[model samples]
Target: MSERSERIIKHSNTFLLPDLGEGLTEAEIVRWLVKVGDVVAVDTPIAEVETAKSIVELPSPYAGVIEELHGEPGTTVPVGSPLLTVADPAGAAYRAEERAGSGNVLVGYGTVESTGSGRRRKPRVSGVSGVSENVSVARVPLVISPLVRRLARDGGVDLHELTGSGPDGLIVRRDVEHAIAFRAQPASEVRPSEVRPSAIQPSAVPATAGQPAVAGVEARTGLHELRRTPMSGFRKAVVATLTRSRAEIPEATTWVDVDATALVELRASLRTATDPGPGLLALMARFVVAGLLKYPELNGYVDTGREELVQYDGVNLGLAAQTGRGLVAPAIGNAHTLTTRGLDAEIRRLTASARDGRLTQQELTFGTFTLNNYGSFGVDGSAAIINHPQVAILGVGRIIDRPWVVDGEIAVRKLTQLSLVFDHRVCDGGTAAAFLRFVADAFENPATAFADL
Candidate 1:
């Protein structure tokens, strides 16, 4: 549990959404597990809500008969807003100081005081096989995360067929995603195989005023025809952070092209059948860490309230990864202490977790600087946006073979472009340029650059 907020547990019949710490402000209700008049025990999962970082099952802090639910599915509820009302006939569980359990099960929030243990009911079984109308014969699969269940349910993927990749045969989000990708088919193609001939008959759908005329695709002019998806809490959080960064930080950009033939050859020589050695990005990250240590001015953020620039002795390297939800930059804490191999392992782990939408709040916060490998998207360059609070972000473009002048002779060399965007208030162009030059030089001559380390 995080120690950011110190508010007491709700002693009244109404239970507000608890503070999901790490500066998270709100969550979107994915679905409610309990309805009005349902009896619930303390710590019983009442709803599945999605915060900016991940989906969470919100446990009930009060155990009683549920009287009313405050919000519906798909509604956004701010932190500290009322979630539901419970009617305590005995009036014992609603006391602020004598609440059962520590209420410390949730990812971020904690209780003011707790006694007695909480009760939890067993999860109800649901059908996961697509081939069956009845699931009484199917075995219960081990699934823990509500997000994973939601993904599997939405994509029509059969969870029984998948082998869990997580601990103790726990089916994770990525397992379902892999199944969905492998089993995905067009509706027309899938219907013939999965549905009976009698069930395949097309039913007449009413032609609504703003609905599309064609079955496959249509362009309707009416305003009602426009598809509008509500902005999610994740997207909202991103918008708020980027908006704040743009409004508060004075930013500048600097870039340089480097001939990275030596670095490329160096990585290739280090690779063998048993071990692939450190990844190219890991080598670059090593260079970035070294560069930051050499120029500490570009490694920290400016404190607006204190009118001071807080520079840290260590680095938390943020790697920008594109996930199904959105762009997330999960940081590697104390990256300055890690070797290229260590960075490689952490990068791979974080990248996989980021894509699967399983990163924790701690992993997603407190990034000091960011490294974006937009090169994987097949782009040459980007004057990237500065991640809020952090002063700079470095983007590496696609590494490709290009003509270069080597000892006054034209030669083909592996070349790439590096773009650095930093806060202008934190450092002048000369400082930013020098930092960029240091990284570029490292890329050009890995042996010399690494020797200094």
Candidate 2:
């Protein structure tokens, strides 16, 4: 369990959406496991959400019937906004007279005091989701936030005249903004001052009203326009990181061809029906560890603040994993200390977590060097971008049967390409070439590579 779990065990009137990762401000609702009126236990997963980093299961905070769901699936919700509301009899009663919020501004797991006594609200009108059919049309919805109240007051919008569209009929800033917009528009249409017995509209302003309508394709005066999508989430993050990598580091690339026939056979010989043993990647990783140990200059970082190129005492092997969601590099700490089988298991664990979008922040950070196996994509070779802060990244390409000279005789051999991208600030071509040649030599002679170990 995380250290925050101790404080997060408290029940609350509403589940405040959490910052999913690395200051992620928002997440899209993928699916909801429960609806209004559904009874849920504490920590029960109520929704599956996709943040900028990963897909997460949002758990319920209070054990009671769900009073409301703040947003529908496919909706993007901001962190700190209400996720859902639950009717916790015991917990709500404890804070009934206390309106003070938790001191933790960014995040909290404390209970919230509801309006009036701690009485259970009737299940909302079915089919309408979170709306109650019996709620008075003329009555003003509860205004909870001081910010929203002040915004409405300054805008000359009467809260009592408008019904809220938020969960459990809570008035939000967006609601006030909409009311202000409606009033500002020419009063030709039925003044949207109150809920007009019609279904409440979310913040979705019609394209013609606030902005030009472009349904995937944009309208231009002259040429044809293709689709346009707002760049968000993982793809957005990738662009930012890659852009920084290109801007900050002075990088260089080096490549070499190797005969991996011996390495393949050695791995096959170690496999059995009961235990398949480590894979070629793991063997390559062991070779990398050995190479880094010999060429320690490549296993280091460049600290621009100190204007220093610092070498690390140990190697943290970062395995670059490509998932459908995005590319994530999860590091194996102190990888040089692990044996072949142990390295394989760590690689598998990080790979699974990356694919499943369950990788923690710790798993995704702190690396001295990286191994990028682009061979899985069936590509011959690629000069990859170095993961920032780390000075080097090694890429492995696909192994294919190719003609090679063997002991002065031309023969077919399993050939693979070894590519290295290194920060020029840390080391020159000589050091990079040495590291590449070392790995290639290991692949060429696996028995000699593992002889000492």
Candidate 3:
């Protein structure tokens, strides 16, 4: 077929809303960044779309003047529905010729033709979309992925001048570190301090002569018109999840003190011998998993709808990581099967991914249990709420030297408090207490607990 014939047959380019989560078929258009007659380039952010998973920015695929915006903000469009149309009649024909010759299309620049009008018959309208014009908007120009952009915004890092080191010179976590390191260097070797004139004193003007007669008090206008922008996709998702968890789960908490001296000593000894030893957090995670194996009821979920306590055979431990956008719980799959070193490696990887906003849907979902390490923040204790459906969450406190009784004598020992929160509907107070006790015991004598398991 002639290239001109392909061009003539090609119709308008249809931009569809991609699936944002586990087959999430629809999403609400949060806002449009461009208007009709505005020129858009491929990969330029055209609109903000909110899905059940998160709020995401949709980029344009075809470079042209925006022909039309198919839906307004707050309207939910199906996954394959036309979000907007770009004037790309000639580009469409070129795509067909390339596809026929090479059997492959260019990335992020090709168009997917629609079968019909590609508009949903019924659009959903639940939440408000769009930003107020009064808000102070800052334009950040950074060559980074959407995930990296989200991460940088949350971390309060300026991305304008940072050099990227990823594929195609894209910005990544390491690039951020490099920027921080570069800025931390001293400006010069011998910097002179500014010396102020201590002896010189200025003559004060007489109160009556220096003060000019005040005219009628001038009125000043204040920034009284406040504008509130709707939450971003990620922020909205976090709120929805936390709200659902609080509403559906009947959570209860219990706290216990553990002598963590043994665990600490073990970690120090192991680090001296091993090149890269298991960190304290990883060692504790292993002990926690072992404890879960002994107390299987704690490694289960409460299905309130069906009135069933669903016990999981595999243990996937979710680590609650604080990210720039919000809290994210990314799972270490089959944590029970991993050794102390293995668990540590996986936990580090997962947490880094969570902070970078690179976690997959599966990693963020289906966690059998959760671990919140408040100790990282030097907290002694906190009662964390159980993540919805999951029966239990474990919180770790900071370890400190304290007075304790040993052989009927006062002695100094390293102690840390452990908090266990569970769904009261699925497990009782006694079970929660016993489970924490078991964890404490395993940490005190990890060799005995992990010897055969």
TM-score of each: 0.64, 0.69, 0.60
lDDT of 2 by residue, 395-435 (tens): 99999999999999999999999999999998889989988
* lDDT of each residue in 1-453, candidate 3, tens digit only: 454445633645668877676767777887789865467789989998766554567899887656557765656788888888776746544545434533322122233333246421221111111222232212123232344545455544455444445444445554554443333334533211111122112222222433532221111322221223456555666676678878987888898888888888888878754376889999888878877887889999776678788888989999988876577788899998888889999988987876765677788886889999988889999878777667789999999999998889999999999999888877788888888998888777777766856
Q: 1-453, model 1: which lDDT tens digit per residue?
A: 222112122323798998988778899988789865468988999998889877778898887777566765777899999888776645333432333543322211122322235443222345454634433223456565556767877887776666666555656665775556434323445522243322333222333566654321234432222233789999888998899988988888889899999999999998999999999999999999989988899889898899999888999999999888889999999999998999999999998888777787888887899999999999999988888889999999999999999999999999899999999998899999999999999998999988989
Worst 10 residues of 1 by lDDT: 104-113
Among the numbered candidates, top lDDT falls to 1
* TM-score, predicted candidate 2 vs. hidden true structure: 0.69
Instruction: Compute the lDDT of residue 14 as modeled in candidate 3.
Output: 66
Question: Which residue pairs come into collision in candidate 3?
Answer: 55-233
Give the distance in Å from residue 364's predicted Cα in candidate 1 to where it truly belongs. 1.7
Clashing pairs in 2: none
Task: Indicate whether candidate 2 or candidate 3 has the larger TM-score.
Answer: 2
Ranking by TM-score: 2, 1, 3
